[model samples]
Structures are given as C-alpha cells and as structure tokens.
Target: MLSDPSRKYRPFPQVNLPDRQWPSRTITQAPRWLSTDLRDGNQALIDPMGAEKKQRFFDLLVKVGIKEIEVGFPSAGATEFDFISGLVRTGRVPDDVMVQVLTQSRKDLIDTSFESLRGARAAIVHLYNAVSPAWRQIVFNMTMPEIKQIAIEGAKLLRDNAAAQPDTDWHFEYSPETFSTAELDFSLEVCSAVMDILKPTPDHPIIFNLPATVEAAMPNIYADQIEYFGRNIPNRDSVIISLHTHNDRGTGVAATELGLLAGADRVEGCLFGNGERTGNVDLVTVALNMYTQGLSPGLDFSDIDEVIKTVEYCNQLPVHPRHPYAGELVFTAFSGSHQDAIKKGFAAQAQRNDELWQVPYLPIDPADLGQSYEAVIRVNSQSGKGGVAWVLEQDHGLKLPKKMQANFSSTVQELSDSTGRELTSTDIWESFEKRYHLKGDGRFRLIDFQESQSPKQQDERIFAGKIRIDGVEQSVSGRGNGLISSLANALESALGGQLDIIDYSEHAIGHGTDARAAAYVECRVGDGPVLFGVGISRDVATASVRAILSAANGA
Candidate 1:
C-alpha cells in the first residue's frame, strides 16, 4: 500500500448546489423499482444464467411484485435475444407487468432489440451512450457534440420503431451512461434532445436514467446532481427521472436513497446487490429500510429465505452471511451484552399492546421475514445468563428465576470455555437437569409424602413422609405453617443439618392434559453456600417436596 496515497490519487469534485432541498426532505413512499438482474447482474457473473436459470429468475422477480423487469440486452447474443423473444412468443408477460430490453445507439442493435419483443403487450426500450469527458477524449476520441448526436439518433430510431409497432404499448428510457462523472449541462442537453424526438406526454412519460456508472463522489453530491436535474429539466411532468447507482464507493444504497429524496421517481438495481465491481445498490436493503421507517416499499419479502436461495442458485454466488436483512447471522446475537439486551427487548415486546415493532439491536422483526426466534440468542463463552435463560425458556419451557439464572450461568460458562465452542439448547438443558438433580436418584429420595392440617393450630400443617438417605429408608414427621415449610423441617430432622429456604418459585410447564408443574428451590444447608434445585411432576405438592430433597442432597 502506498503510504502517501495523495501522491497518486486525486479527490472527486463536489456538486455545485448551495440550496439543496433534499437534506430537509423525507422519503414518504416507495419509488418505482426496476430489477436488472438478468442484464447488468448476469453480465458481471463469470458463469451467467442459462435459459432455465433466467426463466426461473424472471418468475421470482414477478412473484416479488416487481412491475418492471429489464430481462436482457437482446443485441448481446442469440441466448439473450431468444429469452426475450420466448417471453413474448409464449405469452408469459403479464398484462400489468412490462418487460424492458437494453440496446446501444445503433441501427442493427435497435432493430434486433425491437425484434426480441415483437408481440409483447407492453415493454420499455432502453438506449444508452457514454458521454463522460474521459470516454469522449480517450475511449471514443469524439467531441461533446459528436457524443450528443449519438443519443439524439438513438432516440429517433427508438421513436420510429415504436411507431411501426403500434399494437405494443411502448415506453422509452434514455441514459447518459456515465452521468456520475459527466458535466451536468451536457447530460441535460442530451436528454432534452432525446425527449424532443420522443415527444413524450404526461400520460406516456419518458424515463431519463442517471446512473452512477462509477460512483465517483459522496452520496450527498449525487443528491445535489439529481436535484439540479429535476429543477432544470424541461417537461418535468412528462419525464420520470430514474437513478441507477453502483457501489464502487460502497455507498450505492445511500446514493439511491438520497437521490429519491432529491426528487427522482424510480430505482434500478438487482436483488442482493449483484453486478459489476462492488455491484449495484441492494434493492432488498433499501426496501426494508423504508419498511422500517414506516413506508411500504411495495415489494414482498415475507419469504426472504426463499428469495436468497433462488438468487444464490441462479447467480451461482453465495450471499454473505452478514448481508443486511437476508443474512443468516444478521438476527443472531452471541455477545453477552447484546444477548442480554435482546432478551429483555423480546420480553418487553410480548407485553406491549401496540402493533409497532420495537427491539434492541434489531430494526425489524425476524418473524416478519419468515424467521424463527430460536436462533436469536445463541450460547457461547461470551453469552450471559439472559441468553442461557432465554434458550431454556424458549426450547424447554423452563423459566429459571433471576438468581437461579445467575447461578447456573457460571456452570454453562465453564463448559463453553472448556469445550471452546457453542452449546446447543439440548446441551444447556441436559446440563441444567444434571446440575439441579431434576432426574435420577441422588443422595436423598422421596418414597412417600402426605400433608394434613394440625388440629392444635389452624394455620399449622404437618408433614409425614418416608425418605431414603443413601439407600437407608426412614420415616420422618414435622410440623410447620405450610406444606413447603413442613417438608423443610422433615428434611432437616432426617439429614442432621439446619436447612434454610432462601428463595422458591414454581410454574406450569405446558398446557392441557400434558401440563406439568416445575418447582425451583434455593436453599443453604448449615454453613455451606446457597444451592439451587429443580423438580418436575404432575402434582405441585410432589414437585415442591422433590425440590426440597434435591437441594438437601446437594448439601
């Protein structure tokens, strides 16, 4: 890497707009979206989509509520032309949806582009030419007027072709290929000349696509350029200003968003941002961002996983596991602090009465996109008590008390650290059962138990039960204020130690005929530290007695 990068590189110039209104504006609705996955996206792939893959992708885009789809550049090859022709020939194009095809500013290519969509009900014929200074001087070696004439001629060809095919509804789109680096005045002049030849009306609007072909400046500068064009363009109501931003600076999504606020009406991109270089702006991220801000993006992503699978299969590219809303790990929390906050957020959300979504570190609900809550909090060495407790409650229906969660977290932490890996819900539950003696016989076991009110004291209760101590059976009897207290007394008398019940809690594990009770006890025997015990049964009283014995055995 060069230590002095300024010696080799220069900074991009800023847009000349002092009073840009986009800064004070907010996006209130979704823009008209165009998916260029089959054109721009496939062109960038090492292994582009074949006939079957392209058809599958087309079906997916239509299912996802995209009204305009740029199917392919027909003049590129027979494969491209055949696919577009098939859609028209087979009557696959829906009445409400429009298929768009791309072409350069030439006679034969334009004719072939029209031939591909010979009988479509409606379609967009898009034309583009490079007009940036670098292209004019270095690539084409042409003057500004020569470049402007290319767009003018292409617009006329597009107009005449549509005139001949009067049966198909035709919409024309013109793009200044490298508008991101071209002079604003020259781009406007080219578009104006094209619009004059097309002679668009408010009912039949022309589309002027301004692409950040190579994202050259900050996003705000692009917004300034868009606002400038919208402010000065002729026949504003008869033209729909569109934006096609690339991610060269890793800000394509940002530029598209700001451009919308800057008065653009349409967006063009691919699913998961698949295109050349850093790829096009992600339509998924931008749409979901709008959804989070309470605006409907007019697209369906309810089954986002299915969308990811289709895109991966068609593009032969794996979507990153950390991609914004569609990634596998975007909704999972493994950090102690993050897990704790998310756990608390879910708890709070369940109690709220409103319909709005609110959760910490999560801008959107995973369930809204067909994701379950089981993966939200995973346990590793970095996890805290909240995460462990969440896993237990969600998977096993064991709501450990606050103190119990803290107590058992250390055990789990030690296991995770020693194993040096993540622990599944089953691993946590099995360890919990073993730690508290919820299953199998330990040092103490309850053989039989009975409770009755004392005749001497109306509030006092008597407990008489047979308990086994290390394989020795014995009968023990004690009296106390309640069933739990009397059990504690009986255990203390038989075990020869002072048992102090510090904390206790219980809840139903399930519902209906299969319901079972779970009881937790925090107790200290003599001078030892506090220990936790858990017991489960159909009878609440039996669960409580078993819990006392479980804790006493630990002592």
Candidate 2:
C-alpha cells in the first residue's frame, strides 16, 4: 500500500476547464461552520491561549451559534484537556451543540482526548494522521502500506473510544491530512476503510474532512478534487464531506466555497483567518458573504463588533484598520467624490432598499456591521463640498452658503493633505475663519490684559484689555455681562470696528490653577458686514484683537 512518492502519476489527468472566477455562481449556500480558533489558533500562538482565555473564548464561540466547535487538541497537553473538562462540567453547552476534540490516531492520544468528553450531550472525536506520499516518506517515515495500516488501526481506536463514551452520543470525523496533494485513489481507499469500520449512522453521520493543508494549487483544482471524491466515494450519502483550507495562496475562502459547490457540507476555520504561516480561512468573511446574498449565515454574528473585539483580545492581535467588515475605517470616505456618491447612494437607498442595489459607492452598509453613518464621511484633503458641508450641518448646525461651500472645498482639501490627518468639525471652522475672515495683517495685536469679576455688580462686570495697533498702544474699557464680551467690545473701540459677540466660551489649558484660560467668539464681519468670523486665544485680549482684525479683513 505504498503511496506514489513520485506524485507524477495522474488521477484523471485532464482538468478540461478553466477555474471559475471568485464570487462564484456555484457558491450559493453557506455550509456548516466549525470554528477551530481554540485548537488550531492555540497551537500557532507564541504564548498559547491560556486556560482562562481559552474557556472564555469557548463560551463565546458557542454563544455565537457555532454548533460544532473544535475545542482543542486535548491529547496535546494537560491544559487543553483540563479546559475541555471545565467546558463540559459547566453544563453551559447547549443540547444541540457538539463539543469536538482533536487527536492523532495514536492510541494513547486518542484515549486521553476522549477523557475530556466524559458527559457531553453529543461530541465528535476528530482524528487524523499524515496521508500524502511526501508526508509518508518525510514526516511519518512510513510506506504507503504502513499508512493504510495506521489508518485502519486509528479508525478502530476511534471507534473503541466512542463506544466507551456511548453514554453521551458520539460521532467520529477523520481527515486525510493534506488530502489535496495525496494520490486520489490512495486517499479514497484509506477513508473508505475507516468509514466501513466506524459505520456512522444518519443520526450521527461521520465527516470526512479533506484539508488543502498547503494551498499548492488554484481553487478549481481543489473543486475538481472535491467533485471527484463526492462522485466516487462509497456511502458518502451517509457521511459528510468537509473542507479545511489554508490561505497560503490567498484563496482559502475561494477554495472553500467551490469545495462546497463540489459537495462539501461543512467548513473549518478561525474567525479572522488566524493560523500559522498564512493562516486558516476566515469564517467571518465567508459567513458575511452569505449575508450579502440575503442568505442566513446560520450563526448569529449580527453584532460583529463584539466578536472582533473578543478575537482581537484573545489572540493579542490587532485587527487591521482596513480589514473588511471589522476595520476601523472600512466604510469611512475621505475623498469628496466618494462621500458625495455614498451620500446620494444612501439617500436613494433610504427611499427604497432595492433602488441602491449595486451602487458603485458602497458594497456593504456600515450599519450592517454596527458602524455609524457618520464614519462614512471624513473631512480631509481629498474631501469635497458635500462632505465638508455635511460636517458643518451635522456638527455646527450651520448651513454652508452654496458659493461658500465651493470656496471652502478647495481650502479644506488643502488643509487636510497638509495636516495629514482627519480634520475635526472644529478644524472646518478654523479653516473658514482663517482663510477668509482672518486674512488681515497683524498690524494691531493684543499685548496683555487681565480682569477681576465682582458678582455684586448686576450688569457691571468690569472688563479691561490692552492693544498695540498701527504703532499706537492703548488701554480700552467696556461694561458687559462677562469677561469675554467686555474684552471684545473694548478692543472693537480701540481698533474702530463694530463688535457683535455671538458665542463665548472658555476652556482650561492644563490640570491645575496655573492653567491658562482660552476664549473663543463668533464676531460680526465689518467690511461686507454680511458674515461672521471666529476668534480663539489663551489670553482674552489676544482673542479680541484677533476677532477685530479677522472681521476687518473679511469686511
């Protein structure tokens, strides 16, 4: 039974047709999901998922509607085994849910792995051994016939182990490790022999998971392989055909979907494709693919934020900010054209859901992943009139004049690319006031000023400020309700401009009493007398000086 190490022998050599494109027509329905984040993900960790984190993640997996979760390789170590024990003991596992444990076909490992499922409602004992010719020669150091013998022996051991745990309904799953690269006939023979000895019933059907351990070829080759096995494998009607693929070639999801079309009934993966080397296929991406087509993912991952957070924390890996569905800025639009298109797309979609079908602006709604519409538009260098005006209307309740919107759009873009960051709503105000209203030369400026308040004076809150304008220095005076307004009025007289303070506020500069006070004002424009300018400063006199100059220049 020695496998052909040459790998040159062809199994139905002619593949005849080219591989189908992604977003395949054959990939219509979602398959049964099996999350191996705990088992497969754990093994890949430099600091493996500890007992507490593993147990918590286990509960989260089940609660998220993953009916069949590969808990861990119980036989690998005591921590995984103990973690499994705690999972079963808590009685938190749903009746319909199945706790799956992985082990090699070796007798000692199989026995130890089964010990973790003493009282499970129903469970799968997953066992495997290397089956490819290269694995036989290099890794296992066994001949093909020796691999067959081991496969048979492993099946018997798994059968015996399940029989001992008959009190809890048990099922079995066997994988021909790296079956994608193995000789077709050899894989079928071993899997057939194992199934015959195991005899999986309809109530507890066995699963034959063929893993493309390394993505050596395109998805179409994998599809042809699945189609061949599904068509030729004996009693496959009583067994489930499953797929476990990696992302080494960046087609793990593609391979998985086509494998299903070729007759795979289940998929095994991690949440965000976390695994060794390239990583396992991402279940979230595949599941949401189904959602986009209006099909149920079967698992309740509607609140994907919580799931992303939990996985990010458990793996101690940060989710990439641009990662689809779970990224911080996946739906954010910084380009003005993009924002305009997205906004219009949303408006059209709002009137009717079907109208926005296939809008070029967005492939998925941000809200679907619990992101807000606000995140959909960000003001920056590439931002446009629609995006900037949108921010103004939303944040400041100020409607941008049509001409003003046009003028500010270019300036906003310039400021954004210059800053190289997301511009806040406040930045928009500063941009407008600086470019237009505050373009005046600083011939006159506030030097120093301080004021003391006596609450006993009804409308006589005393205000004092100093000004040095056009080589002339002056001390000004005014009577107003507050320090900020009094400072503005006195400075307007010294500079000879009409002062109308629309809004006034102060902010603490630092932690303690020595912290300087900053002030801001919306003052009436003096030249055109048709607009307003915003002024800000740490010193009240400086604020008034700038506000008057801003209005004079703007006027």
Candidate 3:
C-alpha cells in the first residue's frame, strides 16, 4: 500500500448538475431487465458454459420470467455463432422473449451477428465501441470524430441489414462502451449520430446502453451523469436508456439503481453478479431490493434454491454464503440476540391481521423464496435461553416455562462449550430428556397410584400410591388439601425430607384423542438447588405425579 496514494491517483470528477432530479426521485416500478449470462458472464468464467449448459441456462432464465437475454457475441468464433444459430434453427426461442447478440463496428462481424439470428421472430442487434478519452488516446489512438464515425457507420450497417431482413422483428441497441468515464457531451453526440442513421420512432425505439465498463466514481455521480444525458439527448422518446455497470468499485448495483431513478429504462447484468474483474451488477440483488420496497420486480425467484443450483452449475462458481437474498446462510441466525429477536418477530408476524412482513435482522421472508423456518434459529454456544426454547418448540412442540428455559439453557451451553461445535435439534432434545429424567430408570419409580375425596372433610383428599425405591416396593399414604399437595405429602413422608413445589406447568402436546399431556415441575429438596423435571403421558394427573418423582430423583 502506498503511504501517499493521492500522489498517484486522482479523485473522479462529479457531474455538474445541481438541479439533479434523481436525488429526490424514488424507484416506483421495475425496469426492463436483460440477462447477459451467456455473453459477458460466460466470457469472464474460467470454464465457460458448453452447449448443454448454455441451453439449460437459457431455459432457466426463461422460467424465471426474463424476457430479454444477450445470447452471445456471434462474431467471436464458431462455437458462439453456432449456439446463437441453434436457438434460432431449432425454434427454441419463445414468441415473447427476444434473443440479443453482440458485435463490433466492423461490417463483417455485423453480418455474422445478423446471420446467427437469421430466422428468429424477434432479436436485438447490440453494437458497441469505446468512446472514452483514455480509450481514444491510449487504446485506439483516435480522436473524438473518429470514434463518433465508427458508431455512425455501425448504425448504418444495422439499418441496412434490418431493411433486407424485413420478416424478422429487429431492435437496435448502441452502446458507447466506456460511457461512465467518457465526456458526457461526446457520448451524447455519438448516440445522437447513431439515432439519426437508425431513424428510430417512439414505437421502434433505439436502445442507447450506457455501460460503466469500469466503475470509477460514487453511485450518486453516476446518477448525475444519467440524468444529464436524459435531459440533453435528442429524441428522448425514441431512445431507451439502458445501464450496464461493472463492479469495479463494488458499487455496480448501487449505480444501476441510481441510474434507474435518473430515468434510465433498462438494466443488463448476470444472475449473481458474474462477469469480468470484480463482476457485473447483480440483477438478483437489484430486483429483490425492489420486491422488499413493496414493488413487484417483475421476475420470479420463488424457487431461489433451484436458481442458485442452476447458476452455480452453469457458471462453475459458487455463490458467496453471504450473497444478498439467495445465499444459504442469509436466513440463518446463530447469534443469541439476533435469534431471540427473530423468534419474537415470528410470533408477532403470525398474530398480525395485515399482510405486511416485519422481522428483525431479516429484510425479507425466507418462506417467500421457498425456504423453511427450521433453519432460521439454530443452537450454538453463542445461543441464549430464548434461542434454545425456540428450537425445542419448533422441533419438538415443547414450550418450556420462562425460568425453565433459562435452567435448561445452561445445560445446553455446557455441552456446546465442551463439544466446541454447534448442536442440532436432536442433540438438544436428547439432552432435554436426560436432564429431566424422562428416559430410562430413576431413583424412585411409581408402580401404581390412586386418590379419593375425604367424607368428613370435603376439601381434604386421601392419596395412596405404591412405589419402588431402589428395587424395593412399599406403600405410601398421606392427606392434603389437593391431589398435587397430597402426592407431595406422601413423597416427603416416605423420602424423609421436606419437598417444596416452587413451580408447575402443563400443556397438551398434540391434538384430539392421540394427544398427550406434558408436565414440568421445579422442586427444592431440603437445602439443595432447585431442579426441573418433565413428564409426558395420556393422563394429566399421572404426568404431574411422574414430574414430581422426576424432580425427586434429581435431588
């Protein structure tokens, strides 16, 4: 790293538009989207998609509701030309979807591009040439007039070819390739010259795709540039402004959004921002961002997992685990506080009368993208009582009491720390069974239990039960005000200790005749620490009795 970076680098200049309307504008609708996964994205891949993968990806893009796709640069080679030709020859292109092919300003390449789309019902011919000063002086060694003539000559070729092929619905797209860093007026001049040659009307508009070939400035500056062009360009109604931004500065998506606000009509990018250098603007992020803002993005990502799988297979690159809406862990929460808030948010969302989605730490609902809630909250050493309880309730249908949640969380935390790894729902459930003495034999086991009301005192109850203590059978009896108290009295008398019931709770685990009651009890024996117990049975009374015995066993 350089100590004095300013000496070697200069800050990008800002657009001189103090009256920029984009700053106050909001995106109310989705712009037209064009996926370049087969062209720009394929060119950037280490192992580009073969014919089969390209066909599969094309089908996927169609399934996801993308109407415009840049198929490939037909003039690149036989493989590129053959793929575009195959889509046309086989009649695979849908009636509503338009396939686009790229070409340079050369007449031979333009002829090849059109030949590739010979029999297509509708197609777009995209012609691009570098117009920036750096490109003119360093790359091409040409002046501004020379660059403008190149664009004009290409537009002429496009117009003549479309005239010859009247049966095909042809749309023309002209890109001043380095528009982001080029002089705005020079870019406007080149586009205006092309428009004059194409002679586009409002019904047949010419697309002027302005690309941030290398993102150099802030997103707001890019918006200013778009606004300035839209305000000054001739025949605005006959020109569709499109944005193709690269992620050179990691702001391609932001630039595209701001450009939309600046009155641009379309966007072009890959599915997961796959392209040259850092990558192109992520179309998924831009579209879903609109979805979150209460506007329909016009694209369906409902089965996002399938989309990820297809994109990964075609691109041969894995989507980052933290990618905006499609990543695997985007819906998961491991932090204690985040999990607690999300648990509470789900509860509140379920009880709401309206359809608005509101949840903390999650900007969009995972279920909307075909993801289940089971992965939303996971248990780890960093998890708290609420997170642990959430896992139990979601997986096992046991809503532990507030204090009991805290009590059991410590046991889970100890195991998590010892194992030094995340715990699954099964691990948590098994630990719960062992902690509450709900599994296997314990110190005291109930063989039979019966209770009846006292005739002399209606409020008093006589409790009698047979139990096995360390393999020894015995009869125990006591009198108390209620069934629970009477059972406590009998246990204390036989066990030789003062047993106190501090807390007790019970609920049905399921529905109808098959339902079973779950009971939880917190008990203190003599001077020992309070212990928790759990029991489940078809009879509520029996479940309570086993709960008390389970707590005693803990003592």
Candidate 4:
C-alpha cells in the first residue's frame, strides 16, 4: 500500500455547504422593474447601437410590456440627445410609457436632460451626484457640507425644471452616488435635503435611489445601510426608496434582495448586467428572481430570448452562457451527472401526472420566456438516457418511452463526442428528427402543386395540386376559394380518399428578401390530428401538399 505511486484523490472545486445561504425572500414584488437596457445597457457597449437600433430596441421593450424604460441620458452625449430627439419628433413614444432621462445634479446637464423631454407625455428626471467620503475627496474634492450644498442645489434645479413642464407630468428621482460606500448619516442628510427642496407630493412621489457604485463591502453591510435609511428616512410614506447595485462583489442579486428586504422599492439595471466597471445589477436575473417566486415584476418579460436579442443588439454585448435566466445555457445541462439526474427527474415527473413536479432539471421553463422547449435538455458528452428522452419529450412533443431512451442517449453521446461543441435547442431538435423520425423514409411523397387567388371567393382562394405517393403520379385538382381549402381538396383527390384538415399555418421562414417561404399543416387520421411538415420552395402549392404528405407518411 505504501509503494503505490498514484493515490485516490478528488480535487477540482467544491462549494462549501456552510457558506451557501439561499435568501429567504427572493424578490420584492412591490417594486417597479425599470429597465435601463436602452441607456445603461447601451453605455456598456463597445459598439453602442445608434438611434435606429435604439428605437428598435425601444419598440421591443414596449412590446414586452416594460412600463418604465430608462430611454436615455440625454445630458451625457450627442448621440443620446439625437435619440431623444428622434423619439420626440416622430411622436413614436406611447402615452402610458414613461420616458426616463438621467442627468447629474450639475446645471448644464440638468438643463439638457429637461430639454430632451420637452414634448414627452410623462417623464422622470433622475438627478444624481457623488456624495461618499472617498468620492468627495478624490472626485469632487469637496467636504460633506459642500456635497450637501450640491445636492440641495441639484434638487432645486430638478424642481424648477419639473415645474417649468407644468403641462407635462414629471416625477423627480434623486440618486446619492456611491451610496453603499458613503457614510449612512451623510447619505441620509443629502437625500433628505433633496426631498425637502423638491417637496414631493403624494400624487408624484419622490424617489431616492441609493447606488452601490463602488462596492467596498459585503452584502450585509449594504443591507444594513438600506435598513438604516428605510427606518430613518423622513416622509418615506410620501416617497419611494430605490436601489441600484453593481456586481463588484459578485453579489449584486444578493445585495438587491437584501436591500429590498430592508425596504427599497424600485430597481434599475440592464438586462444581463451591462454597465460601468463590473456592471450594474442584472435586471433579468433580479426581475426573474421575483417572477419565479410567484411575484409579478409589473413587466411581462416572459420571452427571454427576444429580450436577450434586444439587449445584445443594443449593447453590442454577448451574454455569458452561465448567466441566470437569459444566458444561452442557463437552462441547459451538459454535465454527465447533471444530464443523467435531469433525465431521471423528468421520467419520474412524467410517471406521476397526478402530481405536478416542478423538478430541479430546469429552474424555469424556457417556454415562459417565449423560448421553445426544444433546447431545455440537450445532449452532450455529459448527457445520458434521461437527458435525451427529455429533449425528445420537450422539443418534439414526442414522449420517449423509457425503453427507447438508451438508444437515443447513445446517439447523443456519439454526436457530442463528434462535435466538441454544445448543441443548442434548435440544433438538437433538427438532428433528432432527422435521425429517428418515421417521415424521413415514408410511404407518401409530394411531387408538385400550385395555387392562384383573386381574394374574391368565399372561403376559397383557388388552389390546385399534384403528388407522386408510392411513385404513382396522382394528378388532382380543386376550386376552393381559399388556399387551405383548395389544398385540402387537392390532397383528398390525390390520396384517392379524404382526410380531415385539422390545422394549417403559413409564415415567413426568416427576415428580408433572402427569407425562404414555409408552410405547415395538420391532418387527422382515424382519431387525433398530427402536425404536417413542409420545406422551403418557390412553389407555394407544392409546399402545402408536401406538408400534408409529411403527416400522412407518419412524420
């Protein structure tokens, strides 16, 4: 035993169970999730999106139901002002959507910030200044009293500008820059001074945002500061306390949760943590943190993929695969053990329909974010039977009986070994269908077809068709006024029989002129209707008939 050169050892990385503390309350429901994706997210970009891209991103934000969009910091730079101008000139902004403009407490910037929102229906003018001891000494070279003066002056400026816009509603928001690092008493003093000068009414409540700009301490200390402010801040009933934390501690989410628990009401951050230095708190992670806990984030950001695309496009940034919720691989498992466990968990869950088991395999269903279920359980070197089966069940809606799982698992292992790359949800679905689907080599085959319409027929749009099922040239025709109806008639005559047309859909394959056209249909057999399949071709009618045969051939 002593002569053995190699020793049984285990060494890599291990998370100490004792050090882990899953926060009791995940997210505060009462707070509004004001996405700074367009502003902060844009600033974080190496190649910041221009006004057009910004507008497109803004449209997506609005579509996703984000009520408060930090549209821009019109005071900062030329590009920003131009973007703000575009929003104003086009009259593109929605009535209910509050356009938030950020600016410092400085006179020029405040003037510029207000100038940007001239024609806005409603707006929030956020004024901020550095007030921490270190910030005062290093940046402003000012003492605490001097900083307090600056805050009061800034507050007065905001009040005047807001008052000037009497025709439009303006809610005032003040931020004590580097708040987490600032002395608690000093922060309270400046924030209180600000509120006093502004004199926030109940109808338009004042918001005091404490930012952990340079995180110099643990999350608990930050929580303590929030609690102290929450308990001590005067006229808080007539105001809303907000938090903006950074990820220097890698505990932005944790800090945010603690801060809210200690009494902050609003959160401002980028979609996936894009900002100065290490970045501001990730709004997606923070917002979804509450959403998963059964709290409404006041924004319907269920389609996370679309959200990420907008963030990526505007910020010109790539999301870390490990990032929570919106990351490319957040819901993906590529480890052998993880995949195996997930596969088993899904199997167990499926076995007992009587019990709804929201298992650990996926923290959140990708479908919740408007993501298709295909990518949930992907196959890789780390994958096994359970993972493969889950992939099939979720993506294809084809329940993989446990017996077939082993073979599929083997195929997944082979693919993973071959590629040396992680397969995406869409990739896995395509590969799996190609390999195992019955339609790949089936009895029915579509040879050709066509359709013509005048938009004149009642439920008929002039369709005709042809096919070569079992190599017999089956020429068929119909005069249905609608495309779907004509195609249904064409298929019935071609097959020398009739099948129920269950469903049909036509959509653009992709964007632009290069986009291939596609069509899909569902046909009923003896009982249930099965989804038909089709491919991209110039001939539209042929595509429709192909769709029917795909289902007829047991696709």
* Clashes found in each candidate (C-alpha, N, C closer than 3 A): 0, 8, 0, 9
Off by over 4 Å in 4: 1-30, 351-356, 372-538, 541-555
TM-score for predicted model 4 compared with the true structure: 0.65
| Residue 289 displacement in candidate 2 (angstroms) | 1.0
State the lDDT at 443 in candidate 4: 58
What is the C-alpha lDDT profile of model 2 across 435-497, one tens digit per residue? Answer: 654444445455666666756887656666566666567877666776655665666655467
lDDT of 4 by residue, 97-174 (tens): 888988887899999998888977888888888887778998889988998999899988988887888887888888
What lDDT does candidate 1 reach at residue 113? 99
Please, what are the lDDT tens digits per residue for candidate 1 over residues 490-519? 778666777888999999999988998989
- Ranking of models by TM-score: 3, 1, 2, 4
Order of candidate numbers by lDDT, starting with the best: 1, 3, 2, 4
lDDT to native, each model: 0.89, 0.73, 0.88, 0.70
Q: Specify the poorest-scoring 10-residue window by lDDT in model 4.
A: 12-21
Q: Can you give the TM-score per candidate against the true fold?
A: 0.68, 0.66, 0.69, 0.65
Which pairs clash inside model 3?
Answer: none
lDDT score, candidate 1, position 361: 91
State the lDDT of candidate 3 residue by residue for 1-555, as single tens digits.
899999999999989998889988999989999999999999999767778679878998999999999999999999899999999999999998999999999999999999999988999999999999999999999999999999999999999999899999999999999999999999999999998899999999999999999999999999999999999999899989999999999999999999999999999999999999999999999999999999999999998876876676567577777789877678888899998999999999999998899999889988888786565322222335655675677567787887888889899889878987546667788888888877637777888899999889999998899988777888987788877778889888556787888999999988999988989999887787997887788999889889888887787
> How far is 114's C-alpha from truth in model 3 (Å)?
0.3
In candidate 1, position 514 carries an lDDT of 96
Root-mean-square deviation of every model: 13.0, 13.4, 13.0, 13.4
